[model samples]
Target chain A: MRTFSKHTPLEYAVLYGRFLSLYMRSKMQYKMDTLLTSAAVLIRECVTVVTLYLMLQKFSVINGWDLGQLLFMYSFVFLSYSLCILVFAGVRDFQGIVHQGEFDSYLTKPLNPLFQVISRRSDLMAMLGHGGLGLILFLYAFREAGVEATGMNVLKVVLVLIGGILIQGALLLVPASLTFWLTKSSQVQEVMFYQMRGFIAYPISIYPKIIQWLLTYLLPFAFVNYYPAHYFVGVGSGGDGLAYLTPVVGLVLFGLALLLWRTGINRYKSTGN
Target chain B: MPSICSSLTKFMGYVLSVNIGNMLFNVWTKVAPVLIVSFLAFHLVLPDQAYMIVLFLISLLLGYFVLYGFNLIVWLSAFWFHQTWSFMTIKNAVILLVSGATIPLWFMPAPLEKVFSYLPFKDVYFTPLSIFLGQVPADDIMLTYLTQIGGIAALHISLGSCGARRRRSLSFKEVSESANVQQTYPA
Candidate 1:
């Protein structure tokens, strides 16, 4: 939770809810700006979707999955990424935070530094646009994939989404946290966030084996969308059981990322006294 | 000549003082995507064609200028509208889609392909990719490059000059403001 201090998880949730309300209050004051920016985000996302539609029109299927299945995978990825962006907007701008000597303020507070970093800002506009569109696409693709709207199926989808957010958050943070040592790591973050994750929106299988191996073993982005979608859509290379391992992998990776973050903080060189 | 030499030295000094490691990382992020895509193209989709490679290389050279000009325009737009981040996202999305980074131009609808052909967006990515995939005929390559050169010239002179003018005005404003403050405060 964003406000996790010495409080219980429930208390953290309540405090985070209050922070959410505060953020919303400030954000809602700029209705037109929010509306326009949200529309911008929506249009940017639609461009990708439209491109995918065009490609599918040319070739009915890519790597074995049809457009419907690809959309389902992409939707999951989009939903998770938007959730991470909303919750961890602070981490995304870690370079700015470090440069502006804002990290010191977090250190002085009696809160988890990571929580403080993450909960400082919430991108409501991105969440509304990216998440709303992603959800719609997910449902449309779900029906196309003939995934029954059963309660268990819904629960699995929810879990996969959570796993996705965790994985994406960890990946975003790992590069960002390097700012502690590197001093300026926005470029590194951009490489991961923009290039690597952008490629993940499509099926990783289409890539050569080396890339597939890199995404699976080194980066571990495959678990974020591909593996889970495999379990749901039944359209991937073997290890159906690995699909269920999404949450476990997410949790483990998040833990490792936290460890890396803590280590980076220890190595942090403050701007000035 | 003396002024140009002094300014060049000053620019070099500034560049040297800036963290080279960070600069390299930034450059790498830009270049690495092209490398990855090239790797994918070579290994997965298309085999190496000798003539196509020559065309691809030339297109890439032209694309460097075209993309750099476009980036400069976008960067300069930030001076006018501080909220150019979203603008950048939209711009990149449109470029990626129209330039055949997302879908090869040959596969696009005929009308759509024709529309994009008239724009410089295809010159950025599609021209090179299409060349590498042997989609472009050798006969048309000369005309394509000529068109690209015209575009490169227009963009470089127009947006490029505009950016230089903006920078000069901004520096003049800063100098005047600082002088005024010094006069008032007597620092």
Candidate 2:
């Protein structure tokens, strides 16, 4: 595998943007498929929303949370997800790339293979979904909670949320990078995603001490959604010590993923297809 | 050449038969939609038959329609998920929020409920579960039911056509490539 060549930062940015545009065009090649998939996906996501709505139908408050706060958490979760999809659209095919011997091309490129892989598919549709969900979340917060929409607050929350998304997207590489060593289709990445969705969506305060500790201290999903989100909701700060630690922490984890990836690359036996 | 072709045909058809059988029977039956329908019918309609069977049936129909759409989604997603095994968290969040397997939506925060209402997960449980309880309004619920049932049928035909074509294209490419390799040296 060849190392990515250094380029002027502006030139690299333009190149990356061009790649993104091409990807969007490629995805559009299957216009009907894309539309149907988007509709189907929208319907699928709607099902989840319906379930939560009905639960509220039975009772007014969940664990003392009003509708607005829950919306904040819920929106953040989906919003973070949208960000992950938008940023990491192509990462899902890590194993397939390995199988097809597609990874060989990255070694011959001048840029980081990981960046190339992540940016390969620009999921504009998914990004739109994320934006749609976020809009709904904010709108509801404004209407129900009587919170005034402010530029500063929006900036703070969105910026922090983007940071959260970055961590989540980068974290995806950990399991994806695993494909480097295993070579076969890897499910570890899927398992971890399930973990994030199942455990991280709810308020972690309800969890047992050990499990909460695991999500909070060990995996750091707590920080991804529950912690920094508090600041966004104006419920409270992330806390004194590391309330705002998620962004840096996500970067650190991403760094480790890269290290593991670098180590795994040595073990990669490319068919060079 | 004829003998080789006939035997290969028989062999391939046999493999295809087993696969088709499993897909139609085992996989389809085990999905959440079928289970939801059966359970709703048994628990709501059977138990309440003495009082209001019509209401129960209406409720069951609504629920079944909603779940049917969801099943189609599962069917589609199963392929992507199994193939890629990416985005496990999103799937998990989706199942929990949509399915109502965990927390009931009524107890969730108001803003949360608003978003949840649109999500298909809650729809999976709400239409059937609520209708059985006489919670959903008759007129609106009917619209919901029609959409799901109609959507399922449409989705199935579309996805089947698309998937089949892609597979055929792949095989066609393989055939042409192999033939080209043979022609190059005139073996």
Candidate 3:
């Protein structure tokens, strides 16, 4: 029954555009609240950067990476995370959808359930907050780290940004898909995704070898920022070679996440109200 | 009256259980392995004085109370603001930075460190960790303990005042409705 979506790609895009506009308008209805919340998010994110700056002021460098290189690497995590949430807020909140019996409504629709989920809501405040900071950091650190951007390098950065977004989205999707069996996966997602992502904000090499291995093999959050930063900044010790594999890792992980999502959907039993 | 006391007891019991569970998890996952390895490698040096351990434990207990009071205030703010996620997130971020959970306070600029020293956030993490590491000088130990106790008392007093204000502003109809719901639920 869930073999194919009847809607074409163009139709899906149009529907998604409508969803985006609707979400934006609804959010805009309360301008003050939106502004305050966005500002709060911005300040919350800046706290980590401030902490990093303070630490760097004392030590000058950590794991042989200076403040500029560190920020350059860290900016990718925020940029990709903001964009990922923009597109995949629905997936992130899938537990709520399932728990509220909204998944039943999606199943009834002619559109793909995943598409419906993907286009349901966009966190514009978070996007603005994180994206604004990320852009500032990237611009400042790009020059500070002395990464001369030719057209080719700019294109590569864009590709890496897309890959990073996919990897982060997949990270959210995998835990969300577990809500089908677990009924509640937010805590798992919290520890697995958010808590683990904190490790990558600094160089993972600074951490214990066990934690480094956990981030590398068990979670692969390193591929999100650390390895890609290596590609651009060329400073980290090992995994310089793995820098080229960012997009590949992202694509593979995303594909696996989709497979998990499909399996979850197939097994889904709506909570009958 | 008995029911109210029992409910309070239950609430405290739940909080204590959760805190113990978290403590055990942290000790097992984070502390135990390193301690065992250090002992096996003969690289671990026990503190010369037993009072240091006692002081550290006292600091830890005070730290917990300080944090609980701080979080209670934040949780109570929900009565005024219907949505508290932003407040909680901002609070967590502030605590993470000021408490030296992310970076040690000594790493901070002198002026900024002075400012944070005035805040209660440092008592939650920085004080306990510093005490454990034996970084708090013997002369300052009593002073640190006084500050931690003072912070807890200040927080509790503020919480009490907030509760009193909430009670005064609460309408009879709202109270009756809540009481009725509670009676019906019989929790």
Candidate 4:
């Protein structure tokens, strides 16, 4: 078994591909279950978007955000989240791995534990469901919001989206890493990550000053969508230079998360199951 | 009968656990802090009318029963379907959309609003919220209560009949299986 440290980035990428394909093949064995679960997820996500659309029909706009811009903003959350879960499903479900003593196997292997955890699983259903909705919303809203399909703009959008995905991964990783000390960190992830993300589905400016501050400085989910949407939609205020800082924030937070994960791995003791 | 009682106890325990979780996680972490901050820093004022508060609580309690009935019906459908998660998901999505939890009923399109008015989903969330917001008129409060009560009664009646039918079918299957076993064994 080759140690993970000796493997080049290209080799890691190839291994990741292999692991992903293996999981995908396993998932494909239950085609009906996969389809149904994906459909359920799609419908679940559609409810909020549909509700917003319906509400917009009556109200026209919410806190200076029109339907198109709002959808564009919302697309960021779903699209990035789908990609994030695809890459980080194992981390997000780290509690289950620990509970089942599967983490012990990862530790025993010559491979990096975090890499093993990440490459262990992917939520293809969530990726399909959320990614499909997000693509539809992005395509529709790109035209409706009048965002030009210039090369630079496209590059910027792609970069910002990558940053958003990283931010979401870090959010999941931090709470999951807490499983080293806490028996149940899923609730912490639920409130800190999921619930907090819900607040940023719309403009953070609409929230109270305190919440805005919290999103800006403390949790920093604002960099995920609100900031980038301001740059793309060109309507919201307070994101002048902050819009470009998403990648920086994402990188910094993800780095810190890795540090925390490293510390947690060192502290980890087996569940003795 | 004893089995039914045991299952009922288990169901109640499940409901109790859910409530406890909501109180501990949701109310304690999310709702309480916001409410406290609003009350202290922002000087938020709740409705002063005691009777209105009582009515709101009553409606909320009724709404809980209405939700419980709906969930029980879905849970009982496990007898028919190998997987009921899809049903639960669809049900939850429908409830989230139509119950005025996501968007107020007034904000919904006219036809959708009209359709939702007839749905038990509205009574679960919208009615209680409307009553709390003082949108429901004094004379109409009783009517709203009646509609909620009516929804609960209708759901329970259907569930009771469904459970009876399920029990009968299960017993029939068991008896036939036992009969086959006796024939094969020459008992």
DockQ top scorer: 3
User: All models: lDDT?
Assistant: 0.75, 0.59, 0.81, 0.82
Worst 10 residues of 4 chain A by lDDT: A29-38
Candidate numbers, best DockQ first, in rank order: 3, 4, 1, 2
- DockQ winner between 1 and 4, please give it: 4
Check candidate 3 and list the clashing pairs.
none
Runs with alpha carbons beyond 4 Å of true place in candidate 4: A1-4, A8-11, A25-32, B1-38, B41-45, B80-85, B168-187
Cα lDDT for residue B142, model 2? 62
Error of 3 at A79 (Å): 0.6
Question: Could you tell me the lDDT of residue A269 within candidate 3?
Answer: 81
lDDT per residue for candidate 2 within B75-169, as digits (tens), equals 33433332111222235447556455566565666887688676555655655556565566656766766644654466557655754544422
Ranking by TM-score: 4, 3, 1, 2
* lDDT of candidate 1 over A1-273, digit per residue (tens): 245356778876776778777877886786655565677678789888898888889889988889999999889877887898888877877877777888888888777878777777778788877888898899799889768899998898888888888887888789877888888786777667666777787788788889888777767788888988888888868567888878888898889988899899888878873
What lDDT does candidate 4 reach at residue A170?
93
Local lDDT at B160 for model 3: 81
Each candidate's DockQ: 0.26, 0.11, 0.32, 0.31
Quote fnat for model 4: 0.57
Q: Lowest lDDT 10-mer window, candidate 2 chain A?
A: A234-243
| DockQ, Cα level, model 1 | 0.26
Assess candidate 3 and give its lDDT.
Answer: 0.81
Better of 1 and 3 by TM-score: 3
> What are the interface RMSDs of all the models?
7.5, 10.3, 5.7, 8.6
Q: What share of the true interface contacts does candidate 1 keep?
A: 0.50
Q: Where does candidate 1 clash, by residue pair?
A: none
